[model samples]
Target: MSVPPAPALPVVGDGLLDRLLPSVATSLGVAGLARPGDRVLEPARRAVVVLVDGLGAELLARRGGHAPYLRGLAAAPGSRSVACGFPSTTATSMATFGTGRLAGEHGLVGYEAYDPATGRAFNELSWEDGPAPRAWQPHPTVFEAASAAGVEAVRVGPGFFDGSGLTEAALRGGRFVAASSLAQRVDATLAALRTRPRALVYLYWGDLDKVGHVHGCGSWQWGEELEAVDAELRRLAASLPPDCALHVTADHGMVDVAMDRRLDVAHEPDLAAGVAEVSGEPRSVQLHCLPGAVDDVLAAWRGRLGEDAVVVTRDEAVSAGWFGPVEDRVRPRIGEVVATMTGELAVGDSRRHRPELLALVGLHGSVTLDEVAVPWLCAPARRA
Candidate 1:
């Protein structure tokens, strides 16, 4: 007997995140943003979206023993996690989630985006009073609608993120509640929920991502962080008011890219030829080619990368619906060629940035299920 082939690539409408957006928007009472769904979460007084960074569906399942509470939630009915769009990184994924739009519409192309206007590669998440949020993201977040529709909207996270560029770009328009720890975030979320009859609280946790970046996804440190996240989720769920509901999800997942498998484009002269700039993480790369070098660039990369990655021309990705319906405005943000790693790796030029990026133990920014599938754990309304 032979094993069946893996399921087909996820379609735009069928992915987990696409289906959950409407339910979430409806529960929060934001009129137009939500898609159609059964309003199972009743009482609808308040809704919370707990975003756990790096907790992908596959990682949550394989590493569930470390996260008992979260695991239980996934096992429950009406609880599911879905794959995020291409280049499963936090910046792009969060923008997709906050806007209810695909990456193509939102223009948050990746973790390290080459801003077309500036022609510079910068970390969007680490922006510090440098760029204008509206100019950078140029998309209206769902929070904007929540605030306009008279729902009390709030963002609960670390004090450092009170006005970070990514927060403002993808999740601004809500009141910021600064908290230092998971417990504080939980307390903040509950307080925000009860402040008004219609409220939308967006809570964030970064422990899992932090641990996974430092230690591999299979490490003891990552496990401990998952346990802490699980405990916090359970605490938040139990403390919700009678009319409230909680939706726990994540930005992306993690995969351990062995150092030996990493292909350093800087070292590979053929792969680097005609390539103007390289952006994205170790697992995914967007290669911008010089004028009229697009074909040569693609052929060279496809020939060199071989089976280690999937090398698709920008048009191919756009036509294939990789980033949802590609918008004209987003075309420039995408490169002439996009390389998504499958079994091997794509490394950054350590000479270009910090050493820590190269040293990261766990990584993402690929289309693989391990990096794209995120869990959506919903807690039924307490008094419904």
Candidate 2:
């Protein structure tokens, strides 16, 4: 049996964060930044980019009743959807957004990626004893470019993220303002805007995504969280300083996966055969096979998963433009064979992943419309 072909790939190099951020920075006169073709933001003295994790365009449209503010933005004339790169997870999207580069260029391929130097699956978010963030992703970020060009860049998020690995790799060069609550984050963003004539504020809200992961995206808990986020966004928009714009976007969308649809690779002999490690999130799995075992693993996965997944070799994925011109240095970090969940099914290795991870109700990191498409809601500054 052969693996089914992948679904149509997302349009990379445009309508995504890699271009969106650079265009935002360019609008602010950031040196070395070029304007993207589809410029979404207008020239403004200050810009507030709010990243709502797991808020997919489809999810937002489906659950619009719960988020009036976001819904209105979505209904606006120029509002549109953008695609996060392949394996549309937080770490990968953030790297692309921050650096204005693809996953291949930034090298943060997924939540968990193979670090060739360490020969282990390292968590990109945690980055504990792994490679140095600067060394791992050496690209200068949009925030850094803005800061260098005399535009104030500030990041408002959790206190622990001030110097975390992901922050350093993708989001460094901004004034780190630790704000735990949504209200606090909004206040911090407003304050940062007031301090500089030209500023770029990046605010992160994760409650909805967290709730979605545990309770599923369609659950009441997720709806409640979305309401809270919508209220906060309303407040943020209403409180924006003069000549400022608030751009709301998300890292990726998610889908609810039933436990019955999840395949545990650890218990399956053929799925585990010739596999050295299983990294990446459940929805998009990376199989690092043993020497010359790539064919066996691919065949095994293709035969078992059938039409449920799109399994391809690393080279095939790169050629298909999944990672967007993968560089030589970043090649080995990718798995020998990659499997992306095309539907509601997920593949997990229980031996490697935690029970909580395997039990996650909502999952992303695939190219499905529910996972890759996110809203780009623009709320220009309005006077009181």
Q: Of the candidates shown, which would achieve the greatest lDDT relative to the real structure?
A: 2
lDDT tens readout by residue for model 2, 1-384: 354454458663237767777877776777677843647456777888999989999999999999999999998865788898888999999999899999999999989989898789988888867798999999899999999899999999999999999999999996999998999999999899989899999999988899999999999999999999999999989888768877899999999999999999989999999999888888999999999899899998988999888999887888788898788899999998999989779988888788988889999999888999988888765543
Q: Which residues of candidate 1, in runs, are more than 4 Å off?
A: 1-8, 11-22, 36-43, 128-131
What is the alpha-carbon lDDT of model 2 when measured against the actual structure? 0.88
Clashing pairs in 2: none
Model 2 earns a TM-score of: 0.96
lDDT of each: 0.79, 0.88
Task: For model 1, state the Cα shift of residue 188 in Å.
Answer: 1.3
**Top-scoring candidate (TM-score):** 2
Error of 2 at 337 (Å): 0.3
Measured by TM-score, how close is model 1 to the native structure?
0.93
Across residues 230-349, which tens digit of lDDT does each residue of candidate 1 receive?
Answer: 888888888888777778888888888778877677688898889888877678888888999888888887788788778887777777777777778778888878888887576677
Q: Runs in model 2 with CA error above 4 Å?
A: 1-7, 11-14, 35-40, 382-384
